[model samples]
Target: MSKLSLAETAELSMLLEVSANIKPGNIDRFHDYEDTKFRHFLASAVLARDVFERVPQMTLGEAMYAAVEHTNGHTGGNTHFGAFILLLPLIKGKGIAGACEAVLRTTVEDAVRFYQAFGKTQVRVNREDEMDVNDPASITMLREKQMTMLDVMRYSSETDMVAREWTNGFALTRKAADILKEKDGADQIQEMFLRLMAAYPDTFIAKKFGYARAVSVMERAQLVRAGGLSLSRFDEECILGGVNPGSLADICIAGIFTALLEGWQWDC
Candidate 1:
């Protein structure tokens, strides 16, 4: 049994990963993007943990909405919307696979709240439709279709990697957990991150760049993992290439948190 609170567990996960200097295209101790900083992640983790720890129960949407709303309030920008989306289901000890099913099992009320929560965050997607929380019909539509949050995620899963995780049972995150056992310290985090980027081909990069560009980055990442390219050299190149495997990074955060709760000894 671990001694850390869920909040502490969440915070430790954020701290350990963000303090690491080498997360390829994202902000870290070594680099900062113009809009997102390492500190923003730290703050988002604290806010997310606060929402996850609430008692007397919160609906999934309530937890997500509160977490994103509070996170944006603190950071004045979007920091970890994808992370919050992927992670809120796991905060209560549902293994990644179980959480995937759990998400699809959510209620219509949960869908409405999730839509409402999206309205509060600074997420980058275009939201011009029935998802508007203010519209009464959206709730009716949700009820009519019996659309759970995962159902909503499935609609985007074909295009969005994070949404795909909900539909795919968080297979990539589980793969990272297996990888975590083989490496140590910051290297453990970086290695898991790189391998995940290699395996998943980063839909964030695809969305921002093109699909071909994302595949090229994936191939390069696989080479670095295989030692055909040096980690530092490829890390730099990834940044310069504007390839950010952000969704993988978020899953890495959740994987690390789960590992820590299970008392993983990285230095072993």
Candidate 2:
């Protein structure tokens, strides 16, 4: 068994993902947004420890809501909202694929609670017409339609990377965990982040900007991987453009948690 408890692993994953340098546009040890500082993320991660510890005992929706509630108490803005969404199910299911799938088979109550959680964050999300999470009426619609959390995820999957993870059995998160297994040291996390950014147009960027800009970010990442673009320059452009790839960062946290749970050591 891993030495770290599930909560500890989850906390470490959040810490590691945020502290990893050169993450481009996202706050890290070396970068910070005006409103959301690196220390805010640290505070949010620390505050989330108890919530993660309680995840196994809580329903998925309750866990998510609790996490956002706890984290929001410390941070001025959203910090780990997306991370909680991805990590709670994994923690509840103990990182087993089948168990995780079972955790995702949510209830109508789960959808309601998840929307309640969504209201806590300033995290930008793609809006759905029928069941927009930002709309107060959506909660009633969720009940009338009897949509489960998974159903909401399915509806948003095409435009939301986090939702895609829910609908697609967390394929990217699991794959990232597998990739981390092959890497050796703290820098490996940065490498994994870059690779993920290169492959996928970050949905957070897409939501904030446009699909074309999101694709441009991916292409720039590919250039960075191919040694054609300087990492620093890319980071500068993204920060200047307010093109934060937050969805990928959230997955990176979940991936790191899965890796740590499976005995991947943090050499740093």
Candidate 3:
């Protein structure tokens, strides 16, 4: 394998997270989500290579939304929405803080393109009283509000953990990276995943099954991880229960990418 740069490492880390069974509550080599299967994720990863490679030359929002569109065009499902959001600024030769700053600095054009990209990726986002991407007037309102991509994220940061990452400078992922750097090898992925899940209930689960169920999963993670308990049944139950801890998984991937970029060898 060739020596991967930070952007390349971050892109591959998403694929590695998707391929790892030990991450728990994720579709990996051992299990599959009913809607999104193994092939879909593999396809998503393959599609991401060009997007990741081209990101440096693109603006933050441009690269972010375009990658989402590109990935979903191939997979027909939300594949790397969170990864795309997180990796955009990182791949632009910015540190995590720089990435957050870039989000705040995005212009109305950036917001517009990202809004359009929503139609393509179709990532499951909260639309309670908010306008849908399909609503023709949404773009008009987007222009009216003169919102930046960061403004859009701020609108949803209250409930969406992924959005919070963008608005708050990816605090969780950064913290998890610190933990990952303290540890070593592939085991750190599982450890970081659990730590993240336990600390914060998975946003995907909360969106699907309400916040209480999400909290239960977090509690379960606490117990399962504390004693070094068997994760086999937990993994089985999470999948069977339709509990894909996607946000946590996404954050964990960020942590892994951080570790790899910082010269920690991933035990593949």
Candidate 4:
């Protein structure tokens, strides 16, 4: 088999993440949120191909904003905004350690552009006290404080998993990639997703439903992992309660991309 290009690997990661079945609280082949359908995710992934391909020519912030723009044009909602945040750095830096260093080098202009991209998405983010992404005024604050994208990530790292990836050298994402490489078959994605949810309190769920609820979700994932809870039951409960662990999904996509880049086969 031919080696997949960076863009192809990135795009395939998005597609594979969403297509993985029985992903609790997420849009997958068998489930869809009312507003953001599975087809919307598919569209966003396909549309993002060009953006990923263009990453080398754009700054991290530029690539992120462009990706959100492309996704918004087709999906009519935020599907891959978080995924773009994770994937863009990895694609640009070409490896986990390289991505970490790349994020640290981001400029104030990158933070400004990232804010612009945040405005394009309806993603529910945990806001920092000083620079709220939802507020247009935060852009002025970002510039005044001279906060680079790395600075912004550090501020939000405590409450946001995606931002934490930026500050922590993509530790969880790299660990997830290792899990993917160690596992096999189509079930690998679902298994990795469950394991991640079991281990980490998904900040996306925390931001919307409170940290306590997020912990409960993680505990339930642990039960599922241990065979005490059913995967379908967990999926139904999350869907019924509107608990979407989107940040973990983004991380999973990054892991998938990383695994693919390292020549993990798509045998399933």
Q: Best-fitting candidate, measured by lDDT?
A: 4
lDDT of 3 by residue, 29-138 (tens): 77766677877888887777788888767877688776876777553378778877777766664467667667777887887888788777666766574767777688
Candidate 1 local lDDT, 105-215, one digit each (tens) = 677777877877777765555345345556667677888898888788887787678778777877766777778866556568877787787787787787778679889
Best by TM-score: 4
Q: State the lDDT of candidate 2 residue by residue for 1-268, as single tens digits.
A: 3478888989999999999988988999999888889999999988999998898788898988888888885545888888888888888888858536755678999989999998878878655556767889999999999999888888889988987888787889987888888876778898899999999999889888889999999999999999999999999999999999999999999999888888787784
Error of 4 at 142 (Å): 1.1
Instruction: Mark the 10 consecutive residues where model 4 has the least summed lDDT.
Output: 125-134
Sort by TM-score, best first: what order? Answer: 4, 2, 3, 1
Clashing pairs in 2: none
Candidate 4: which pairs clash?
none
lDDT of 4 at 80: 81
Comparing candidate 1 with candidate 2, which one achieves the higher lDDT? Answer: 2
Shift in Å, residue 47, candidate 1:
2.2
lDDT by residue for model 4 (74-176), tens: 5447788888889999999897877987898899999999999988788786554566777889999998999999898888899889989998889889988
Where is the poorest 10-residue window by lDDT in model 2?
96-105
- Candidate 2 versus truth, CA RMSD in Å, comes to 1.7
Q: After superposing candidate 4, which stretches have Cα over 4 Å from the reference?
A: 127-129
Q: What is the lDDT of residue 199 in candidate 1?
A: 81
User: Where in model 3 is the C-alpha error above 4 Å?
Assistant: none
Query: 54, model 4: CA deviation in Å?
Result: 1.0
Return the lDDT, model 1, position 248. Answer: 77
**lDDT of every model, 2 decimals:** 0.73, 0.87, 0.77, 0.89
